[model samples]
Target: PGPLSPSPPQLRAQPQGAMQVGVQARELRQPMAMAMAAAAPGQMVMSAGMQQLAMLPCIDVQERAQWLQEATALLGAEIEMANKYRVLDQVGNQFFYAVEKTDCCRRQCQNGLCADCTSWEVDVLYTPPGGLMQKFLALRRPCSCVCCCINRPTADVIDEATGQKIGSFRDPCTCCSLRFQVRDASDTDVLVVNGGCCCTQPGILCPLPCGPCAQVRFDVEDAESRSTVARITKRVPSCLSWFFAPDVDSYHVTFEHIQNPQWKAIMLAFTIFMDFRYFNVNRNQEQARDVLAEL
Candidate 1:
């Protein structure tokens, strides 16, 4: 599949509840050290330990917002999904992550609060057969970007077992379109995200006639080669669903055809980053106002 622009490809169906899926997350004590010790330059090696932790295969991930108030009550931000969201496969095997924000000011804030005004922390975990949460990928908002709106900040993707960074979500220019670059620890490019339904003009809202087609689409591609690997499509809701439940945006991500296990994790992180940027930057609010005013 290519980018969604030239010709849109048929996307995969969204996965449902986590109750039906069986998920297991193994601890990676020293993922970086093991990766270094196993292979020489120009060669990639997956040790037995890595193979154990990388048990989850590539698959479509579905993320549906629980409710609008539930999100604002937690962080006071205009975010949609601020609680724990589960990533499940077709059969219901699930992995989960909790989105948290800290360093909040006690007084009422302007624009947004918590992650919008402070920092965000995401905890990646998976439940084993016995139902205990195992930590996997941990991410934190970059310090420089937490307070500065002009600076495009990145969220460091850390390996919980070793407490070392394994990758990062690189945000593009704040005035530019909605796009992101995902890179590994070595600063090697992995995935490039080009989000749709975006207004390229800075400080301007989405044009009037585009409201009916206000679906958000993300084209995930190989960063280096620029080949399409996956796609995420969020549909435009009906009029009532839009006005009454504006924040509950559900995204559908497809990655079954992809073979790389690492890519799956990176894509999942990218998915979270998409929401983080959308709410933090106030794009969602702008779009909502535009659509409603037009209506």
Candidate 2:
């Protein structure tokens, strides 16, 4: 007991870089004796070695590996979200460009070649979603003529047998008329519902009376090859009824009006400027936490 109190060996002061060297050795798994020997001569290495040993219980290798894996997966998800946002932003920009370029009404058709401009009666028809065949029809007057004489322009969808009209386009035009049918999976039947002379009486240009305009037929093969189907005729009059009348054709305008609100909201939500703020804020928060932890 007397000699036991002689005490442990006096510890020497640590060298200037001994702490860094010990940290490196711990990370590299060098033998303890070799690491202590590598320290500067007369430097007390026991405290550094003891400190590293004490850290071993608190250093969770498994937890760190799990954290790295989670971080990688989160980064992948963020990148995917960014890509989707980019695509949505592009679509919004395109829609804005289209709206900006479109002309308002009468401004679109200053030239007598109303053919150069889109008509109010015109419609872009495509096969309803989920339909078998994809068909698009741009139906409008063949010529630029306004019809004034006809009192009652009507359309009658009749059963092929007995010539009975089933459904009709209510408003009739004296100058031009159009009707379309998907004849089969591969063909379409286009009938000139009405025809009139292309008179010089000029209010709206009318397609001059052309013979039954032939059965303006279209093949699905042609449509698939060309990607478009358009027909212009001037036989029907450009009656105010054509534009203002409540009829099936008016459905085009109605559909456009109905879709406007939903489309506008969708476009606004996906804009890049709107998304950038959230992305930047989240990134800054993550960086701040990382810095604090490192410190």
- Top of the candidates by TM-score: 1
Q: Per-prediction TM-score, please?
A: 0.61, 0.15
What stretches of model 1 exceed 4 Å from their correct place? Answer: 1-82, 101-117, 145-150, 174-176, 196-214, 235-242, 279-295
Model 1, span 13-80: residue lDDT tens: 22664222121112222235424354545444543323433564443344444465433433435533
User: Model 1: which residue pairs collide?
Assistant: 20-92, 21-92, 21-93, 22-93
Positional deviation of 36 in candidate 1, in angstroms? 14
**TM-score, model 2 to reference:** 0.15
lDDT of each residue in 85-113, candidate 2, tens digit only: 11112112211110111234432342223
TM-score for predicted model 1 compared with the true structure: 0.61
Evaluate model 2: give its lDDT: 0.21
Residue 78 C-alpha lDDT in model 2? 18
Q: Assess each prediction's global lDDT (C-alpha) against the native.
A: 0.51, 0.21
